[model samples]
Target: PLQVKRGIIDKQTGKIAGEEEYYVDRDECNRADTTLAGLLKLPPVFDTTSGQGSVTAGNSSQLSDGASATLLMSRERAEALGVRPKLVFRGYAVAGCEPDEMGIGPVFAVPKLLQRHGLRVEDIDLWELNEAFASQVVYCRDRLGLDPEKLNVNGGSISIGHPFGMTGSRLVGTLANEMLRRKARLGVVTMCIGGGQGMAGLFEACL
Candidate 1:
């Protein structure tokens, strides 16, 4: 069984991220919680493997159609255009893992990104770890010592379907808005790639 997690929790305002897109698909949209009774009813998506394979459709991110976009340019350029900046691109890092066990990509990538900036998990004020699957997300959460309080304060891909091309930018968009509302400093958006790779980026809200 996996921890049923959906919706981001805004630490500063104590609000839950519940956009209409959170449950775009009709499959069990906002249907159940972490109750054992509720979990027992979710259907398994994959067959039982030797040591792993506990993922179920309920705990997995839904595949659906979506799109997101962000404009990246210099602050001077934005100012010249009278456009308000949202975030600053601080740094980025990527790492590889076993393709079959790609869920742990963030586990390796985030640490490298953090070390690059001489930061620790505690230094991050917010996180958007894509919920590709409950299995890998949980593994990263525990392994990275990420604060559940700051992680995915709004609904993640588990709630809203993941659009591969735009997910990373989408996460940065979500993080940028939340960080501004919360008036927070550092936020990190990390997710495991479909293949055996993992990527993470460091961002600072332009406040």
Candidate 2:
């Protein structure tokens, strides 16, 4: 599923260059160390009760190895280099949250972001909220009243794989590309950090 999505995006942008083997595969699924099946069978990290623990390998992000890069340059520089720009970096915000409830990072970060830019949630055309965990995504979506249709249309970390440090850039790249493809105006990319922090950035698709 993810490979097909990447293929389509690669065709559209030609930025990804080519496919990589980091994506999950049948051979990797058969291996004990790298398999999602093996991870799902282990004891619960938080709650032990059946179907009670909110965090699980199935719902949580996969620990995969990958890398992504986003080229940030001024319009003048890009034009001088004869390259087409995709999106304009509007603004960004960072907010701290309780370490225990770190998953709720976006809940606080997003408001600060909007207020700083003097914009409302409805002003944004698309949103990419990292699926670090299913619980976190659900909580943010309900609390923020995000439209399902405007969110992560091509799936997220849970479906593809979270490469930890690479996820922020990955989200930004995905949002920019999708915004351009849809001819949308505004887009936002937000993610919850590991140690009680959230970061968000807003962008405008270049037409």
Best by lDDT: 1
Candidate 2 matches the true fold with a TM-score of: 0.77
| lDDT (Cα, tens digit) per residue for candidate 2, span 1-207 | 344234323666767666544444532212344566666676655787676776766677767766799999998899999998888998999999989888888888999999999999898899999867888899998998889899888777777677768888899888988998899999999988878998889999988
Per-residue lDDT for 1-207 in model 1, tens only? 223436676888889955333433354434555676777677666875564557787788877655688899998899899998888999999999999878789999999999999999999999999967877778899999998899888777777667678889889889999999999999999988877889999999888
Give the range of the ten consecutive residues with the poorest summed lDDT in model 1: 19-28
State each model's CA lDDT, in order: 0.84, 0.82
Runs with alpha carbons beyond 4 Å of true place in candidate 2? 1-45
How close is each model in CA RMSD to the real structure? 10.8, 9.0
Q: Tell me the number of clashing residue pairs for each predicted model.
A: 6, 0
